[model samples]
Target: MSYELSHLRELEAESIHIFREVASEFERPALMFSGGKDSIVMLRLAEKAFYPCKIPFPVLHVDTGHNFPEVIEFRDRRLAEVGARLIVGSVQERIDSGQLKEEPGANPSRNQLQTPVLLESIEEYEFDALFGGARRDEEKARAKERVYSFRDDFGQWDPKNQRPELWSLYNGRIRKGEHIRVFPISNWTELDIWQYIEAEKVEIPQIYYSHQREVVERDGMLIATGPFNTLGENEKAFTETVRYRTIGCMTVTGAVESDADTIDKVIAEVAGTRITERGATRADDRVSEAAMEDRKKEGYF
Candidate 1:
């Protein structure tokens, strides 16, 4: 029987092609490793792009100082396993230097503060192109972004002025002090990610699976009650089986009540879900209708 590329295989091939293109075109390209499922998938694609040799570029993480403990641990472990260099830009240092101001609210999140730190890191490292694992299906703003998203000298993105990409041709053109954000899996959906994770047996952080955690309900979302979100007198904490559909800063990233502890179950869950990952899980996105778009215009990953 004649066989064609399965959906997973097609996605894999497209991602690998994008990785190779990024490697060849940009002089100083770096992979943005957030220790999330998407970034982990990007790392795997990079690994496959240049097998029998080390991934030629360093991985960068704009540490928000409010990450899940499990994700940070997994970041280090994955780096060691792949023997890839990791460069972390500290949000703590930015806050300490007064370059970045901490959010003063009951729900303080460093999610917005990450933009400047990421831009500074790019300038410091002189990285011309940055590989991000942002998929279009995650948000409407991301859906508007091109595969090779060009940024200005100040790291601002003009979504309306993006260069047209046709027939898999990527335009990596950018001026000095300007850069591009390259997304390999921009075409993949959330279910596709979970399916790939299961098929490849990828090791993700424990938080992605079902676990008991103390959470409080606020703003129509379940916020994990931790150091990031101090329990208020009005808000009572309760333990529940929950897992993160999309992971971000601990303060802003909400977990959905779920019992999908295994990858197989997660795939099943994702398949049946009608809401987008960020819509269900990210409190930051709920700030405004154009929150993500505004952040993207300001150089957010």
Candidate 2:
């Protein structure tokens, strides 16, 4: 009998292959960790890719300074558990040093400012390859990304000129001042991530599950009212049971009304949802029709 791999097994195999390729090809590489569900999944896959041995690379977190305390705590705890190194590039430090200017707006997320900080970190560490947890199904702009996304000297992504990856073959060729961003789980969907998380028993932040919090409705999104985000004169905050579809800077990442508190329940909820996770929660993406694409071109992860 011919044995075929299960859906999850096949995805895992592909990701492992990509990981091994990156390990062999790059001189220095780092995993871009955001302490979100997707990045946690990437860490799990990296662990599986090289078992009986520690992950060969360290994790890099570009701290926006507007991050949720819960997620940051989770990040440090998880990294400690795995005995991995974490290098944080502070956005606040950049602003304080006048290396980056903070944007003036009600939405004070350092989302855009993260790009330069991330690039600076990469350059400082001299990393030739970086692994991110971006999936094509998450956004329209991300849908255009190749498995091996190339960035130029200025760290700008040319989406239109991406190389082809036929037969699972990836080209990691780059010159001085250029690097590649690899995505092992680009083919996986939001539901697939939840399913894999359930099967793998991966520990994630509590914010992913449901909890009660004070939130204000803005642009049809439930923005949590806190230090990063506050209620306006016309806006009123109220307590509600909600959960983050995705995690990012607290000022821009919105939560959805949900009662799914467990992994299985969250899987069921994701299965029944039609809207993309980023579409439902990311206020920054709502800025324009091609906002993410524009950011990608300008080197935003």
Candidate 3:
């Protein structure tokens, strides 16, 4: 009898293969768990990759100290369920130590500052490889990256100097001080992610579903009203039914107006939407045409 795998299964197989490869090839590796949809999917894939055995590597989170409280709560709960070790690199700690400075603005974001903290974590832990949930379709900069992206000794990325991944064979070679950022889900799209979550019954933060919350209209996006977000003079906070397309620092991540409360509804909504989540919701990406690219070059995950 002949059998075939569905598209979701194929994606899952590929991601699992990547996970196993990292486990076998790298001596010191960690999964970057941001508690976002993509990272949550990554965690699920990791679990399947090493079923009957707990995940071999620890999970790393670069805390910007500006993240949503709900996501943080979810991160801890999910980590406990999976029995994975958690390693956090705090941006706030770095700022307090005079190693990093907070950006000065009415709407200050710790997004850019996360790069240095991440690099410090890598150095402190001596991680030879780091697994990130970055997808190529998310942004143009990310699209240019290889599945096994290489980072220099200084933890910076040079897109033009990337190694070729000819065929399915990946080169995980790096110098002693160099490292790699492995993206297992580089080929998966936003719609594919929601579909996988729906099919697998993956548990994610409730903030992804539509709920009533106080939000302010800022620069053509709905910004949630919270301690990290300060409304402008003309901006007014009012209740709206909304959900997040992507999760990031609360100061920069925007919410979309939607009633997609369930997983099936989210998948349907994602299928019909033309705008990429980051393009529509992330204010930091709107700072410049090459905002993400610049950050990647400077070692931003």
Candidate 4:
């Protein structure tokens, strides 16, 4: 073809542009940091997008209390290294106070509960704009999201009546009690993220690579060892060479039987794989076809 920018570079440039736009448009905005690879890449992009000056926005994480220890460790250390403020919305706190009920089983996920916690956090902080690590290629509902997704005071996402996004222009216009959810990498794919990670030499959690751990086979995926994974009837745990494609609350997130222990290996494995990231690891989305969409409608970030 012609002499043009590579795919990864192009995606990076677009993401950077979006980051700056959010920074300019919103008075107070926060980047959602999960300490996962996607969020880590978002952090790296924020770093590259605004160098010489610290990221002008705070980063928030909604903790499901069923988090992987590796993710928590990486999250804390990275925030310290960047010298950025971290705000955490706790789901466990909601459960403790009888605001939400905990899922009981070998495969319990905090995906649904995170919605209320996120809404409460937003109301508490009065954040007008929230930057998420959502990608269009992940799920059907997410695919419907715009770069500047709007939400009401209830924090509900209505896909049908979305504001038009022309060219690279985003309209952050909103009324009082309503905020916007921005996704800089909405156009990115999972493979794109990994390629950028490889190209940028971004450091992510070690669990992304193949490591020895105790895992048991569940319905169709491997459920890993964690405090929230209460053993069920006939469930057996054994050590297997595995790594997580996605990390979320322990109860609902599943692991893949992978040997790709390195980032490069991971990239290769994902490239040939047919299943999408959420399809493999997320239990919440599988509850129904409109699972994510329904949650988003109810102010679930």
| RMSD vs true structure, all candidates | 1.1, 1.1, 1.0, 1.6
Q: What is the C-alpha lDDT of each candidate?
A: 0.91, 0.91, 0.93, 0.87
User: In candidate 2, where is summed lDDT lowest over 10 consecutive residues?
Assistant: 102-111
> Model 3, range 1-301, lDDT digits (tens) per residue?
6699999999999999999998999999999999999999999999999998999999999999988999999999999999999999999998999989888979888888888889989999999999999999989999899999999999889988889888678899989988999999999999999999999999999999999989998888888899888778888999999999999988888899999999988988999998889889998898899999999998888
Error of 4 at 97 (Å): 2.5
Lowest-sum lDDT 10-residue window in model 3: 161-170
Q: Judged by lDDT against the true structure, how good is candidate 4?
A: 0.87
Model 1: per-residue Cα lDDT at residue 298? 88
TM-score for candidate 3, please give it: 0.98
Where's the lowest-lDDT run of ten residues in candidate 4? 103-112
Q: How many clashes in each candidate?
A: 0, 0, 0, 5
Which candidate gets the maximum lDDT versus the true structure?
3
TM-score of every model versus the real structure? 0.97, 0.97, 0.98, 0.96
Determine the backbone clash count of candidate 3.
0
lDDT of 2 by residue, 216-298 (tens): 99889888888878677899989999999899988888899999999989999999998888789998898999999999999
Query: Residue pairs in steric clash, candidate 2?
Result: none
Global fold similarity of model 1 (TM-score) = 0.97
Q: Residue 90 lDDT in model 2? A: 96
